[model samples]
Target: MRGDTSPADGDKLGREAPIPRQLQQVQDDDLDPDSVKRHEEDDDDDDDADEGRDEEVAGLVPRLSDEEERSARRARNEGGAKLGRATTTYREGDDDYDDEDHLNHVEDGGGSRSPFADRREQRARRRKPAGVLATIWAIAREALPTLAISVLSLVFSGELLIHLARWPVFVKVDKLFILVPILLNLKGNLEGNLSLRMSTSANIGELDIRRTRETLIFGNLALLQVQALIVSLFAGILASVLGVIGGLGGASEGPKTAQRRGFGALLTKRRVIHHHPAPSDPSMRLRNSYFEFVLVIATGMLAASMSSAILGSFMCALVVVTRQLGGNPDNIASPLAGSLGDLLTLTILGLLGSFLVRFEGTILATLILLALAAACACCFFLAYRNAYVRELLSSGWIPLVVAMFISSGAGLVLDAFVQRYEGFALLVPVATGLPGACSAIFVSRISTALHSGKGVSSSLSHSSSSTLISALRDILKLGPTEGWIVPATLFTIGAGIEVLFLVLVWVTGQMSFGWPFAITFVITSGLIVAASLYISHLITLFLWSRDYDPDIYCLPYVTSLIDVIGQILLVVAFATATVLGDQITAAVNDHQKP
Candidate 1:
């Protein structure tokens, strides 16, 4: 060896300790190519660490050499942003999700309280109800219209009206008889209009407070009104001709005298009889969809017109007043102006109501109602299945239905109690109908919120199943927070709205009380509720069929169906009541005479 230790000798001295058995084995093995690659990766990590250290040194303050300050500032900003987002989400339920969109607030406040505890008991109570006799109920409802119509027609026959006019009550209130037809038509037409608009909205997300949308809704009803006017005029003429014919002794009643009397002369003498189509179409085949809609609207208007004007007025007022309450404030008007369009619609519906009720009789009117209901249901189903409509309807209906079922008997009972002592049932419409309308509005808001990607991105991820499980656990422990709170609020608001409307209707009823009116209103309300439930369920099924995919369309079909049915039921219900009242009156009179 040279004077300095040779390289081999130094290496031997420095590498005196042999590598451990595990390390030796790793180094020796060629089985795992990754072991050798990992060793190479360690060297790259060392190089990166050196570069990172240089960057840190360069960024250091000249004198203070402080890095912590910049880090702290970043932390504070992020924390502040997160807190603001959380706060904003809890309060303003609108679509304001972006961190930058938030209003800056102070430091984190106190812990929040749960908003959904009120429904815990309710949820527990909703475990699948026992099987109801739905078919029996449905059949009973089906037969009700014919029974009611025949009875009502018989009561309003020229002979009965004459007999009734002899009574003191009838002598003073004879003018009120015209109201029966007016109201019957109003209820059917308005409900049909509502269903059409809602269905269109649900189908395309296009049904807004916009002038165009409102016009579409209003225009259709206006046409129906025109149809009603023509129908009534025709009916009046026919009745007059018949009256003149019957007035003459057999063949002596000829065309010349009928013409001289004019249609008006005979109309005043004979009881007017109107004929309406049945619920199930005679053809029962799918024809031109649009044509059917037009027919249904016309029929519904015609049918509802047969009810008393007082009832029609109540129905129209409820619709006109509450329509805005059912709309989504966020919806962009579809080239149509806003509330003005709704006003125009109300005006149209009102005009149609006036005409329909003026001449149509109860028996003929009920058919129009059933036809409308069927038409609406079909439309709703179509729209719900349509990809576009499902998106629109989804935003509102789910919450509305839930709220209705929850508060049903409870709110109605309360309303009954309120009206019992002082005969204040007239307030029922305001109390019940208003809240129901409001609920519709709020539920709409909630659906729009979810669509907005505000609180949480609405899209379910690929791993959503796992995430859902995690979320459920979190919910069980912590209660409903941001996302869930939206639904809860919507549900409550809907319930409140419905309750208000019921109260309003009740209050309005107290102002006038004829046995016919009473019987008709009760029957009409029950029918209305039943039809609403049926249509609502159909809509729900349509919506869920899309697998809760908000992107799908389904609401329009259900809403249309409900709207049509609701209108039809309103007319039928009123007609039934009228018939029941007449029969009772006749029975009482016969008993007194005996």
Candidate 2:
């Protein structure tokens, strides 16, 4: 009705739209122009009449050309306003409706939106969850090459034994075959324990190698020295006893030849020689045994002490450096150190043997022994004075010592069978070193898991598969790849080393066997890696579930088992090669006859 214009008033009515009742009441109050404007503003601010005003503006507006109307609507929509308005108005209590009003903002490219919000949304969309398979692939991607190189380094340790085999002292002392593996394995086991200890300490914030934590460093070093001395001395004594038992009631001709001549020949030769009593004095036998004893003990002490000092310091530094670099020392320290320990210990033992053998029963031997014993005593005293050393001794030292003895028995077994194969002696260091290297890797992983509280419960039952699964999950969480990748890679490295070593041995004329022997060596090396990995996993799981520190217990046990298993496998391989190799060689020789 207000917009209806009479025919006579059409021009006048066209000049203005009808005022609403609210503004008309303000106009009737006789307000000044500015006051009237203020009153009109008050009417426009009314929230309840917003819809009516919008409808009035839409309905009462003059008609536009079709193109103009479309353009106006497009502008209104694009600007996120009401259909006829140029600006948006958010109601006082309707902020939630703002998204609806701005729906076209996205269609307009959203350039007016906050960049950080858009970026956050984009990131959210991009960050999909990494499933189990993806995780395994990622972990294996990082670990495979590192493990391969580490294993390859260990495989080369076989060269040390090759050199040792050519040493005059090693040749003269038949019992060293029984002692070398034990001592080498002992060095790895001991250093591996030190690595684990240092890794755990670093993880727990106890490790500080900057001389301010000298007590902890000295305490650990002392414990390592004492453990090394005790274990190596015990290993030396145990190996000597086994050698005596195996060597007794036999001919003076080397055990290798005596075994080939048949036991009856050996015993008859012993009896005949006894009845006809060679002029050699019994004291000569005692003197020889004593000389072997001095050599084993002296070399053992030197190897243990020197390896502990050098490798212990190195592993500790490695762990510290890795941690500072935001990497897991657990992944790198043990494997690297284990391989290095094998090479260094064997080289050092060979050198010590060369020097000590020259002084066997001389006053120089006594002086060396006294000096070594005094140094060992000083280390033991320092270790005894440290509370941490006392704790390690009470809980950790005995198992390690026992493991050394058990590993010495494995050496005994190797000595018995490996003698039959002429150049199979070269396999000893590689076999023992490879397993220890693998065990060190796995033990470090498990120890890190334990220290980080990532898997297994403190009170979990030892037989629980959940504990094993948890432990495995901790490792497997590194990727979708199975745990066997490490062992398989190790096996590959070992096989390659076997092939290379065989070629070297053949080229050097140290061995006469052909591809059959090489194949057997490679196969045995693979089996050793696989067995070592499995045994290490089981040992770590057992120690972890039992609430014992796997670091202290795992290395020795795994390495000891590896020694035994590796020796057994090497013997089996050699026996297989011996039987089939002879036939293969004969066939080839027959074929070659022109």
Candidate 3:
């Protein structure tokens, strides 16, 4: 395919029909441009030829309109030229009129609507329902299994966090707890961005071809490694700073060993309690000092490095397989990324931190940190050299920071209500995850639409005021275009999944749910889903309007916003349920007793 170099070769490759002369020039510039330039000068030559022909055949000449004369001359001078640019054309060898008829149909300086476009519009009208149904079916097949797995994974992540918080390494090295929310938040952003980008490429057919697939996949992985390294280091540094602040607070209160706190306590701005034990060895004096800080940073980098390598590869493979299987990765990828990021990161963190702590006083820890730094520096250069990811490296940092800060608010809600509600931790994942995934699907579809060269995507892009209400009014116009189907289907699936998860928990006796809880959940989830979709749409348009790529910035902002909204909503739902849920449960029990 690469060896093929002619205009006809593009047709063989199954590119969109009617290759534009612009692309023709790109493929065969020297030959096609020279010919096209000469062809543009044909009117003068035709005039001269007409003058000579008139003199030679004056006796045989018949009166004709100027339009008819031009048509006749075109037919005579060029056998392959159309007899009438508007109605008729000639075909010779590979040179067919199909391209001109379908794509380049012209009435004057501007092209009129082609008959092909009309036929396409009619066919689309006929097949619209079937198309949407088929896509929804495919989405269900891909999404359901992955979502089940992801939801289960998040459940385990929540449980794991509870255990991990109490684990010796985390209890002793309290900064690690503070690192959880920050690093996981940043990692999700990195991976979600990767998944969305890959899904976009798949939708546009970039991943269908082997060469492009390899380039994109490799570039994305490199870019991911660069991002992971940076975020992990940042997490470690932030944790250390917080650790120092807590140490100072604890010192002023009493002569206590520096005590570490959970992500909820630290990020929520609660009073930090540090209770450090006396170091047994001279080398162990580093416990509350820079040595512990460097050690935490080192462990985070290792854990993050490993997690990104594992998760990034999985996401790439999942996207490729989904695309190959005629499924939509956009529906499944982000959800899994969010669901799995915390579990995997913490698993790596707890194990790696404990292992590294054993050698903390030795030179191995310092070497490991230095080595990770060098490796990350090398990855940065590698990603920089990649054309696809170069622009991305410079642009996405702001969203990660913003998302992290926004997530801290969620941490505050979590800390306050976590002790107040039964099984509150279990509900957190579904509350936040389902709504975020629903909106992520919308963002993925819209990003794909915005990146196209022409067609419906072009129709969707326009200048609008940067306001959520303006964006909402603009997006509301998409209903007539079948654009609403994507969000509708995604939300429908999400709600169904949310209900199923509730049933499963009820059956398993993991959490008791009454009529009031059900009503509150349905309302809260629905409200969050609606808000997530509109806000994500607003963010995407706002970024795109300012020349930011939605694929990079949208998901992080959307997920962070959803988490905040979801947490607040969860707290409200639980508060309401605590009142009504108890009464309903008591009434049901009394009826059974009677």
lDDT (Cα, tens digit) per residue for candidate 3, span 1-594: 122345576578566444343345546666676766754455444445455434323322222342343335344333334322222211111112224433223311212234543454455456534587786776777666776777788778877986786677776677888788889989988988998999877765556535446767887898898899899999999988887787668531111132323343464453333454333654337767766888899999999999999999999999887776656677778778877888899999999998987776677778888999898888888777655676677878998999999999998888777656766767888878878877777787777656533223333344333565675556555441235666677677777888888778778667776888888888888888888888877777666654467888888889999999999987888789877744322222233242
For 193-281, candidate 2 gives per-residue lDDT tens digits of 88887776665434422321355667788888877787788778766776676567543344443554486467668879779655553
Judged by lDDT relative to the true structure, which candidate is superior, 1 or 3?
A: 3
- Candidate 1 local lDDT, 1-594, one digit each (tens): 112335566488564332332345456776467875654454344444345434434432111111232222233233321111122111122122222212111111111111221133245356454233442343233223322332223223323433433443222222223222232222323333243334323322223223223334443343333333433333333333433345454342323333544764555455335333334532223222332223334432443333212232333333333333442231211111111222233334334434543333333444655665565455455444333223343343343333323333333343334322222223332222322232222223333333322222222221234454554343234311133333333333333333344344345442333566555545455444444433333333223223343212223233334334444444453445545653212222233242
Which candidate number would show the highest TM-score if scored against the true structure? 3
CA lDDT scores, all candidates in order: 0.33, 0.60, 0.69
RMSD of each: 23.0, 24.0, 13.7
Candidate ranking under TM-score, highest first, comes to 3, 2, 1
Cα deviation of 277 in candidate 3 (Å)?
13
Where is model 2 more than 4 Å wrong at Cα?
A: 1-157, 171-178, 208-213, 239-248, 251-286, 289-296, 405-432, 458-530, 567-594
lDDT winner: 3
**Model 3 misplacement above 4 A:** 1-35, 38-132, 250-284, 453-456, 459-482, 581-594
Candidate 3 at 195: error in angstroms?
Answer: 0.7
Sort all candidates by lDDT, best to worst: 3, 2, 1
Sequence-dependent TM-score of model 3: 0.72
Better of 1 and 3 by TM-score: 3
lDDT agreement of model 2 with the native: 0.60
